[model samples]
Target: MIAIDNKLISDSVLEAQFVCDLNKCKGGCCEDGDAGAPLEIEELNELISNYEVIKPYLTPEGIKAIEKQGKYIYDTEFGWVTPTVNSGICAYGIRDEKGIIKCGIEQAYYDGKLKWKKPISCHLFPIRIQKSQQDEDLEYVNYEPRQDLCKAACKLGKQLKVPVYIFLKEAIIRKYGEEFYEALAASAEVVKK
Candidate 1:
């Protein structure tokens, strides 16, 4: 678990309720840009072993970039850091005959072939989980609550009836579990007043 700012975590856990409305949205979050999630050790191994499976979708340059960077960073605008290659599309991202996008990962989860899967950085969206200023702590930056996002996702947001607290709690619980849910709920409730 990453160590995060208590205050930011509290606020984000509150706001997340407003952001997740699956019914009205077609998982646009999943379809969006590679949110720069770091590959886990297991995931990296999977790629190396089954490189053939995903290689077809990646440009040779992209593959070379990942291979050369090796996930560690030497220098960039952000200074030394672990590079997160935009893995591009989800393997299960498919368009039905009707052109509906579907998640292969969620489908696999439902089918019991995969358990407890979500890209780490993707799961921590709007709530940044990164090293602190001194790299001694993990900071959970709260979502800025973009007005544009509200306009874009409003239809589903309304349908999901995403009360801020509920949405945030659900997000946390989805990633962390019941214990996190209870803690976030407690934090959010106290922060509200």
Candidate 2:
């Protein structure tokens, strides 16, 4: 583990290569999870605040699910999460012409509708974070590749020589700040040697 700030980052995040093969996975992560996308407390507010702006980007089924279930729902294991349609695709998901699922919230952000892109948990996919039991102040960040869904991504990552940390640089920086990412890069350099 590489310790930086309050995080204990797994070496796999620096060693394992990954790049989302959206064409292959077709955004399966958004659909196959047992629950909806995990949301931080603040993300709940962001969804509520931007619902109107984000609504247009959503599919009819998605809007109905959100309307019936509210912006977010509580899960026994995941705490607060975005509501899912028929307990499947995320409530904020829409399908493109190619039938690939896409995040409505992210699309709205790309369209200049909202400042927040999407849920941090969704952004930092394949790297799940949890509070460390060993230390109250520290969190554990680990690479969790799903074999069925992420096979193509793993293959692409290895082919491109892009490590997980580098693959998820933007999301990691967004969650932990630029200095934290710099520290991770430095750690990666040491690991390389």
Candidate 3:
């Protein structure tokens, strides 16, 4: 594990390769999960505040789900998460012309309707963070590779020689900071050697 600040990053984050292949997976990560996308407390507030702007981009079913379930829900197992439609796709998800699920919140951000992108958890995908059991104030960041949804990404990452850390640079920097990411990048180079 590479320790920086309060985060303990798994070595797999440096060794594993990944790059999302949306064509192959068809954004299955958004649809196949048990619950909606995970959300931070602030993100939940953002959804509530920006619902009017985000509504136009949602599907009828997604809109209904969000209306009925509110912006976020608490799962016994997962803590707080965005609401899901029919217990499948996230209520904040919309289907593209290609029939692939996409995040409505992200689309709104791209359209300049909102300042924040999608939830930090969704942005830092395949790298889930959890508070350390031993130290509540500390967090652990790990590369979690699910073969069914991410096989193509793994193959592509290997082909492109992109490690998980490098592939997720933007999200990492967004979640942590430039100095934290720099430390991670430096550690990745050492691990590579």
Which residue pairs overlap in candidate 1's backbone?
A: 16-167, 16-168, 17-167, 17-168, 24-156, 92-104
Error of 3 at 178 (Å): 0.8
Error of 3 at 153 (Å): 0.7
Could you give candidate 3's per-residue lDDT for residues 40-137 as a string of tens digits? 88887898889999999899999999889988999988888999999999988888888888999999999999988999988998999999778888
> Per-residue lDDT for 130 in model 3?
96
| Minimal lDDT window, size 10, model 3 | 33-42
TM-score of 2: 0.98
For all predictions, the C-alpha RMSD in Å is 5.9, 0.9, 0.9
Instruction: Indicate whether candidate 1 or candidate 2 has the larger lDDT.
Output: 2
lDDT score of residue 130 within candidate 2: 94
Query: Candidate 1, TM-score vs. the true structure?
Result: 0.57
The lowest-lDDT stretch of 10 consecutive residues in candidate 1 is: 1-10
TM-score of each: 0.57, 0.98, 0.97
The positional error of residue 124 in candidate 1, measured at the CA in angstroms, is: 4.3
Give candidate 1 misplaced runs (Cα > 4 Å).
Answer: 1-7, 10-12, 15-25, 34-88, 97-100, 124-126, 144-161, 168-171
The C-alpha stretches of model 3 lying farther than 4 A from their native spots are none
Query: RMSD, model 1, all Cα superposed?
Result: 5.9
What does candidate 1's lDDT look like per residue over 30-137, in tens digits?
A: 444433344434554544454444444343544565577653343433333323335443433544455444444344445564553444444555454444575554
Q: What is the lDDT of every predicted structure here?
A: 0.47, 0.94, 0.90
